[model samples]
Every structure is written in structure tokens, then in C-alpha cells.
Target: MKFMHISDLHLGKRVNEFSMLEDQKDILRKILKIADEEKPQALLIAGDVYDKSIPTVEAIQLFDDFLCELSKRKVQTFIISGNHDSAERMAFGGRLMKESGVYVAPVYAGKTQAVVLEDEWGSINIYLLPFVKPANVKRFFEDEQIENYTDAIRVAVEQMKLNTDERNVLVTHQFVTGAKRSESEDISVGGTDNVDASVFDEFDYVALGHIHGPQKIGRETVRYCGTPLKYSFSEIHHKKSVTIVEMKEKGNVEISTKELAPLRDWCEMKGTYMELTEKAYYENLDQDSYMHITLIDEEDIPEAVRKLQVIYPNLMKLDYDNQRTRGKAAFLEAAEVEEKTPFDIFEELYEKQNNQEMNEEQKKLIHDLVEKIWEGGH
Candidate 1:
């Protein structure tokens, strides 16, 4: 049996406040092209089918249209809910979609409820463990003590093993081993949100998500299918791809990855004002590509952005380099506001003001009044 696995689609996601729907659509079209060529038995979307809890009408239409095409081709699709997805919304009409070989696992109503798929080789049970909190699962199993995300996934995997045969795969939306998170990722409480790859030891293979980079965890059996399009400028170096797994009857699998080039590129540049405007720095500025610009100007250059925009009109940022500025000493000194308290500054200001405007008698009265207040603290 052969299949394609990918995750963190984050469809309908915006980049730099710009709609990335066209880029996402292009990538999905490429994925469909790959599917057409390979004709895989199954297509697994691990999680994050949408970018938000409530997706837009266009997002819904795009996903629906994609699924309808897959259904027409008799392709079996398995999807789960990610941290960004609303489970109830994703599961809407899930029962009816199952008839078309599209399965969406969102609710945790029971342990035995999993999507099972098959091919000429044998049956493959897929346990779709969506993003779930420990507290929510605790209500389902009152006697079970769950502590974190790791614990929650362990319980789900254990339940799946109880109901399925040996030839089983775990499709989950979670932070796991071998995943490299970008700066844009929201770090969870205490930074202990990720589950170890070893947690899925019982399953034949693990299709993971949440991280935007494709990687192999602990072993080749556990993998992450990165997002088709780059989510942030921090992900400029990432090579987005999908994992193709070929499974044999003996429970052995061969894996190969195919890269998915995005419709637009994300480019970043750092240079002084003159260098930035030079032909060497931005010779190939694609107006279509998203950009982040860091300016290394010694001083605030007038109309620096206007000048640069003439060359790279899509520039997203312009950062000043304080170190190179002539008045940096004053800038640094102005930033040391925490070293002294308000009372210290108030006393200094009183002396300065008295010296500038008050007579000796007035100064004496002010000193005496402040002295009495200071003595109260003693």
C-alpha cells in the first residue's frame, strides 16, 4: 500500500497581513498533481486543515472543492483536528463525508471510534488523535489521571492499540521529536508541550503535525510533513515537502519525500542604506516575494524606505542600527530608567529647581518639609 502524508497546511493563513490563499491553492494543486502521478492508496492530512477556529467562506470552499475532487478520484483521505482548528466545526458533516472515503476525526466520544482504510495488501487502522487538553479527556475517563499533552496522547494511543490490529498508523496534530519550530510558533505553558516520539512505539508509523518543518523523529517511522507554504520569514530556509510511505504486507515500510515549491518566496536582507540601495544587495528582488529588510544606517536617513521601495516595493520592515548611529551614547543613557527610583529623581529635581528659582528661605522650608517626611519612613 502506498500513501502520501502531509500536515500543518494552515490553509487560509495570512502572512505579513497579506492573504496567502493563492499560494496555498497553488501548493494544493501541486499536491494533487503528485497524487495523480503516484496514485497513492491513501492521503493523510495530519492536522491544522485551517488556520483559525473560524475559517472564512473562501477557505471552506477551497477545502470542499479539493475534497470533492479527491472523492471523485476514489482517494481515501484522513484528517484530524489541530490546535488551530475547532473540532466541532471540522467534524461537521463528517459522518456523511465518510461515505465518500473522507474521514474527519475530531470528537473523543469513544475509544473504538477510528478511521480504518485498506488496499490490496491488507487493512490499515488509522487512529486520528486530534489536539486535546488533558482536562477535557479527564472528564471522559474519570478514574484516569492525565497531566499534560504527553499524557493525553499516551492514553489515546493506548486506547487505539486496544481496538486495532498490529498494522496500524497514528495520525496526530502535536509537537513531537525532530520538529523544528519557527519564531512565530506560540510556546505553550512552561515550554513542556511536546510529546516524545517514543510515545507511539506500538504503532507501525506516526504521522505528526504542529511543527512547520518536515523531520524524522527518533526513527524513520515517525515523521512530520511540513506545511506546503512558508508561514513566516523565519521559515525562509525551509524546503516544504510531503512524505510518501510505501507499506508492504509484512509491516515494513519504505519512505521517500517530494518537495513542494511555494508560489512566492520569502526573502530577507540586512545592509546599510547605501548598500541596501546598491544593485548588489537586491539584484533579484521579486516583487511577488514577501520581504524583511533590516537597515544598517548610521543615522536616521531621510526617506530611506521611500528610496528602497523604489527598488523592492514589497519590503516589510526597516530596522535601524543604533550601534552605527552617532548619537548612540545618549540613546543608551536614556534607556537606563530602572537604575534609580522616583524618590531619588524627585529629590535631585527639587534641589535643581530650588537653585534655579527659590531663595535661601524657601529652600530651607522645603528641606525642612522633606526631612520631616523622610524621618517618618525611619
Candidate 2:
């Protein structure tokens, strides 16, 4: 069976306060076109269908149209709510929609049931597991020890009662440990919401969401299709695409990606104010495309944004990178921040503020407090 895997559409999203409605509309149209060419039997939208739990009216209509079009084409779409979505809202009308092959995961009330599809290989069980926290899962299993995200997921999977004889595909939304994150994704503070890849051992293919970069975790069958469009400057270099998955049998899964071409590409240009404004440098480029212009002039320009608007009207960001700006102390790199826990960062901040490392008593207090907070999350 062939399926198109995509996630984090983030419809109705705003990048640097600029609405992405038109871009989103256009991208969805393109995805529909791709679906036609690929002729996939199913489309897996892992999560984050909307940017907010309560989306704008226009955003809702946009998705409705997309779904209506998909239904018309007789393509099965499977969607799950992400952290940004309200589970109950996403679950609404799910039963009615299931009749049309639009399977929306219900607000996970304990166990996840499978939507079985048959092909030449026999049966493929598609399981929908929405974005779940430890706190959410612990309620259903009081006797189970679900203290962390890993524990929560393990317990949830345990309840699924997966059959080892058949092919299984799990569509879930969560931050699996070791996935590279882009600034666009936003994050869960304190590092308490990470699931281990080992918990998904039973499934033949795991279609994941949350992380903005398309990647395979541990094995190619376990993957994230990533966002269909770039949502932040940090994602400037991402070659966004739709992942196509082909499952042949119980033990065979193949993955490939088809790159998406957005309506307007993201661009970042850097040069001295005068050089950037030069006619020769600006004429050939697609000035209307969303862009970040970095002016390296030693002194700030008077009305630079206003002036640059004449050349690149869609300037999303403007800043300097001159001697004065470069003189400032550097902050921790994203890699460094990812390596340190929130508590570690907090302790470092305390020591820097007070000019001394935390004493043993303070350390113990902080440790206990962190532990309590982590438990409360579950």
C-alpha cells in the first residue's frame, strides 16, 4: 500500500506577524495535485492540522475545502490532533466523517483502535495516537506507573494489543528523543515531553509529527514528514517535501520524499546597506518573496526598512551585522541549549546572577522542586 505522509501544515499560521493564509491555500492545492499524480490510497497527516487549537474561520474553511476535495477523489486521509489542537474539537464529527474514509482520531480515551485496510499483502492496521502527555494517559491507567513521556507512550502502546502477524502503521504526534528541531516548531520547556524510539518497536512503520525537519529515527520506517512550508527564519534552508511511504509486507517498508515548491520562497540576503540596495544586486531576484535582509553597515541606516520596502516589499525581517552588533557577547548556540536541561540552564543563570554556584542545600531544593513539577505534568 502507498501513502503520502505529511504533517505540521500549521494552517492559518503567522510568520513574523505576516499571515500565511494565501501560502497555505496554495500549498494545499499543490499537495492535492501531488496526490493525483502519486495516486496514493491513503494520506497520513500526523498532526498540527491547524496552527492554533481554535483556528480562524477562514482557516477552518480552507481545511474543509481541502478535505472535501480529497473525499471527492476517494482518497483516505488520517489525521490526529497535535499539542496545538484541542482534542475534543478535532474529534468532533469524526464518527460521521469516518463513513467517508476521513478517519480523525477521537480524543484518545484510553486505547487506540486500528483502521484496518486490506491489500495484496493481506491487512494493514493503521493506528491513530494523538499528541498525548503523561498527565493525559495516567488518568485512564491509575494502576500503571506512567511517570514520564516514555512511560506514558509505553503504557498506551501496551493497551493497543497490536497483532504481530499483520503489518501495522502508527500515526502519532510527539517529540521523539534525538529528532532535530527547528525554531519554527516552538518547544516544550524543561525537556519533560520526550518519548524514546524503542517504545514503537511493534509497529512496521511509525509516521511521526512535531519536529519540522523530515528525518528517520533509528530506522527509515520510523519518520517525520516535516512541515510542508518553512515557518521561521531558522527553517530557511529546509527543502520541504511530502514523504511517500510504500509498505509491501509485514517487514518491508520503503520511504521517499517529493520536494514541494511554495508559492513564494524564503530568502535571506546579507550585505552592506549600500551594496544591498544597489540596482544590479536587487534586479534579478524575486523581490516579492518573503525575505530577511541583513545590512552590515557600521552605522544604522535612516528609515532602512522603509527604503528597502521599495526593493523587497515582502521584507519579513531587517537587522544589522556590523562591528557594533558583532562586539556583543555571543549567546549559547542552539546545539548547546538542546544539550542542557531547563534545570541546568536555571542553575547556570542563578550562579551567574549571584556570582556563586548553588550550595548543596539549594541544589537539593531545586532538584526536589523540579521532580515535583515533572510529576505534576504526568
Candidate 3:
């Protein structure tokens, strides 16, 4: 059985105030083209279909179009909600949609539902386990001892009563241990939300989401197929792609990836102010690509961002890294401050603030105020 594993669509996302709608549409078209050629038996979307719990009308329409196209192609789909999704919203019309080969996992209610599919070899039990928390598990299985995320997932899987003899695939959205995170991902405060990879030993293939970097956790079978587009500057280095899995039989699987080409690539450019704005440098680059530029010129340039935007229309961020900006360490020099008296420090601050030395009259006034305060304290 061949299937495409993808996740974290974040359809309505905006990167640095630039709407990704057009880029998302272009990428989804590319995905559809791939689907047409591969003709996979099913497509697995692990989670995070939208950027927010309450997706915009355009986001809903875009997703609807994608699903409609997949249905038209007779391609079966399996999807689950992520932390950013509203379970009730995602689950709406799920039963009706399942009739058309699109299966959407409802809000996790302690028990996981498995959608069984068949090929020439045998039956493939596709389990839809949406994002879950310890509190959610504890609500359903109050008697069970579920202290953490790992325990919660373990209990949920156990409830599925999976059969090891048959080929089983689990679709989950979670923060699995050993998975790297990107800036766009909503990470837990600590390791409290992490689930051990070993907990999914029973499944033949585990399609994961929630982390934006495509990577395997413990084994090849357990994987996170990252976001198709770069959602943050931190993900500038990621070569976004969709994971394709081919399952021959139980314990026999092959995984491969196909690159996703976005309308405008996310990138970082660093150089002096003049070097960046020069026609020679700017002409060769994709001016429309989302960019984070670092100007290393010692002197601040007037309207630097505005000038850069004239050449690189999609400049998202502009920052300076010259000596002036980088001169100050985050911490103050304690010894230098310690050497000065309170009055001396105050006088230095007054000069810096006024951009001039205190006149004799102002100096006497400050001295009198300081003396009065000192006498009162003594």
C-alpha cells in the first residue's frame, strides 16, 4: 500500500505580515500534481490543517478544494486534528465525508478509532489518534494512572486493542521525544508533553506531526513529515518535503521523500548595506523570496528597509549587526558602576540625557537635593 504522509499545512498562516495564501495555493497544486502521478492508495495528513483553531473562510475554502480534488481522484485520505485545530470543527461532517473516502478523526475521547483498509496482501488497520493530553486521558480513564504525556498516549493506544499480527498504521499529532522543533511550532514549556517513541512499537508505520522539521524519532517507521513551507526564519535552512511510505506487508515498509517547491523560498541574506543594495548582488537573487537581511555597515543607513524593499519586494525583516549595534553586552559592567558614587552616576546620566554638562545653578540644585536625601536617610 502506497501513501503520502504530510502534515502542518497551516493554510491560513502569515509569515512576517505577508499572507501565504498565494504560496500555499501554488504548493497545494504541486502536491496535487504529485498525487496524480503517484496515484497512491491513500494520503495521510497527520495534523494541523490550519494555522489557528478558528480558520478563516479562505482557509476552509482552500482545504475544501484540496479534499474535493483528492476525492475526485479516488484517493483515500486520513486526517487528524492538531493542537491548533478545534476538534468539534474538524469533526463536523466527518462521518458524511468518510463515505467519500476521506476520514477525519474526531476530538479524541480517550478511545482511538481505527479505519480498516484492504489491499491484495491483507487488511491494513489505520488508526486515527488525534492530539491528546494527560488531562484528556485522565478524564476518560479516570481509574488508570496517567501522569504524563507518554502515559496518556500509552493508555490511548492500549485502548485501541491493536493486533500485532496485522499491518497497522497509526496517524498521530504529538511532540515525540528526539524530534527537533522549529520556531513556528508551539512547544511545551518543558519536556512534560513529550511522548517516548518506544510507546508506538505495535504500529508498522507511524505518521506524526506538531514538529515542523521532517525527521524520524527513534526508528524509520516512526516519523514526522514536517511542514511543506518554511513558517519561520528559524526554518530557513529546512528543505521542506512530503514523506511517502510504501508498505508491502507487516514489518515491510519503504520510506522516501519528495521535495516541495514553494512560490517564494524563505531565505536569509547577510552583507554590508551597500553590498546588499548593489544591482549586481540583487539582480541574481529571487527578489520576491521571503528574506531576512542583516546589514553589517558600521553606520546606520537612512530608510534602509525601504530602499531594500524597492529591490527585494518581499523583505520580511531588516536588522543591523555592525559595531554600534553589537557593542553593548546584555549585562552591565558591575565594577565600573561600583566605582562611581550615586551623585556621580546621576550627574553622568543627566549629561547623557541633556547632551550637555550641568550648569553651575543646576549642579547646585542637584547637590542640595542629594544632600537633603542623604541627611534624611542618615
Most accurate candidate by lDDT = 2
RMSD of each: 11.7, 6.7, 11.1
Please write out the lDDT profile of model 1 over residues 1-378, one tens digit for every residue: 888998887778776567889988888899998899888888999888998889889988899988988887788999888887899999999899888999898577636365666677667777787887777667777777678777777776776644335477888888874477885455554457777677788778889878887788888988888788888887889888889998887458899988888788888878777887778656756756777877776668898778877888766666775575536657666775757654455555655432245556866677777788878979
- lDDT score, candidate 2: 0.91
Return the TM-score for each candidate structure. Answer: 0.82, 0.87, 0.87
Off by over 4 Å in 2: 328-378
Report clash pairs, candidate 1.
none
Per residue, candidate 2 scores C-alpha lDDT tens digits across 1-378 of 999999998888888889999999999999999999999999999999998888899999999999999999899999999987888998999999999989999998898999999999999999999999998999999999999999999999999999999999999999999899987765666667889999999999999999999999998889999999999888888999999998997788888889999999999999998888889988989988899999888889999999998889889999999767766524436457669976798798786444369999999999899999999999
Give the TM-score (vs. native) of candidate 2: 0.87
Please say which candidate is ahead in lDDT: 1 or 2: 2
Candidate models: Cα lDDT each: 0.78, 0.91, 0.89
User: What local lDDT does model 3 show for residue 44?
Assistant: 97
Candidates 2 and 3, the one with greater lDDT: 2
The number of the candidate with the highest TM-score is 2
Error of 3 at 342 (Å): 29
Query: How displaced is residue 184 in candidate 3, in Å?
Result: 1.2
Which of the predicted structures, 2 or 3, would earn the higher TM-score when compared with the native? 2
